[model samples]
Target: MFRFIWLSDQRWGQLEPHLPKNQLGARRVNDRRMISGIIYMLRTRCRWCDCPAG
Candidate 1:
């Protein structure tokens, strides 16, 4: 079975500073979830559409 991966608070803290903020568009919500999904996809070599819902 595949295990879901999530970003830790410390890791997110380190990454939070590098992410774009308050851009001229819709607000970026669920940034951590989005990043975690991307990381999961890359690590598991799974298709984006095949990713399991949280």
Candidate 2:
């Protein structure tokens, strides 16, 4: 089974569809990713270059 918790950024979905997309060509891929990353970093105490940032 899978468990899920709403991300902080997802709470801003109401404004997503209204924003422009980045160079990645995503009009709204959900800011949840950025928020989630930041949150995970806080919990892991890992440097950005240690993983994704690397």
Candidate 3:
């Protein structure tokens, strides 16, 4: 199957600065991956629970 990556490094670099820091809890290590999954689901019109696990 062809893999889809919605966020490129350059795009993520631009976006990363605007995202809020996680100060109150443990830092999330997979924010980019999680956002990519979300974008893939939205673009593909798949159900949230049906999104593939990367």
Candidate 4:
């Protein structure tokens, strides 16, 4: 089974400033959640659609 680990507040604080803002379209999902999902998929070698929802 895959274990999901979320980003800590401190890490999110450090990373938040570097993420780009979406100015033209609808607001994007939470960066931390998106990044966590990506990392989980990469680590588990799973398809994007197979990744677990938050």
Candidate 5:
């Protein structure tokens, strides 16, 4: 079982400004949640297919 890694509010505040905005897409998933999952996967050296579903 892998633990989820969520960004703290302070960290997210710093990161929020750097994310893309107003792109040509229908919509996007929750950036914070997606980023947290990516962080967890990389830190744990887990395969992309093994990453937990949202």
Candidate 6:
């Protein structure tokens, strides 16, 4: 969701400057994929261990 991304960006701002020399933030991802996965979980109300592997 847009709110999640906005919050993530704010987190990145606080993290970017203090990260260790060899570290990067989280891997970049397609927001749509994340949204879809979340929707699937919400609709099904499945346990985390049951999530389908990509």
TM-score ranking of the models? 5, 1, 3, 4, 6, 2
In the predicted model 2, the residue pairs found to clash are none
RMSD (Å) of each candidate, 1 decimal: 2.4, 5.6, 2.3, 2.5, 1.6, 7.5
Instruction: Pick out the ten consecutive residues of candidate 2 with the lowest summed lDDT.
Output: 1-10
Candidate 1 TM-score, true structure as reference: 0.77
lDDT of 6 at 37: 66
* CA error at residue 35 for candidate 4, angstroms: 0.8
How do all models score by TM-score? Answer: 0.77, 0.42, 0.72, 0.69, 0.82, 0.44
**lDDT measured at residue 31 in model 2 versus the true structure, 0 to 100:** 66
**lDDT by residue for model 2 (1-54), tens:** 223334645556665676566667535554666656667677767687775431
The 10-residue segment with the lowest total lDDT in model 5: 45-54
Give lDDT tens digits, candidate 4, residues 1-54: 557978889988998999998677877887898897777778878888764565
lDDT tens digits, residue span 4-36, model 6: 222256655665676445447886565545655
Model 5 C-alpha lDDT per residue in residues 1-54, reported as the tens digit of each score? 557799999999999999999999779889998888778878989889864565
Tens-place lDDT per residue, model 3, 1-54, is 747867988999998898778578876767787788778877778787775564
Worst 10 residues of 6 by lDDT: 1-10
lDDT of 1 by residue, 1-54 (tens): 778789999999999999988789876779998998889899989887885676
Clashes of 3: 0
Better of 2 and 4 by TM-score: 4
lDDT of each: 0.88, 0.58, 0.79, 0.80, 0.85, 0.58
Candidate 2 Cα RMSD (Å): 5.6
Model 4 lDDT-worst window of ten: 45-54
Model 5, position 34: C-alpha lDDT score: 86
Q: Candidate 1: which pairs clash?
A: none
Best by TM-score: 5
lDDT of 2 at 52: 43
Cα deviation of 12 in candidate 1 (Å)? 0.6
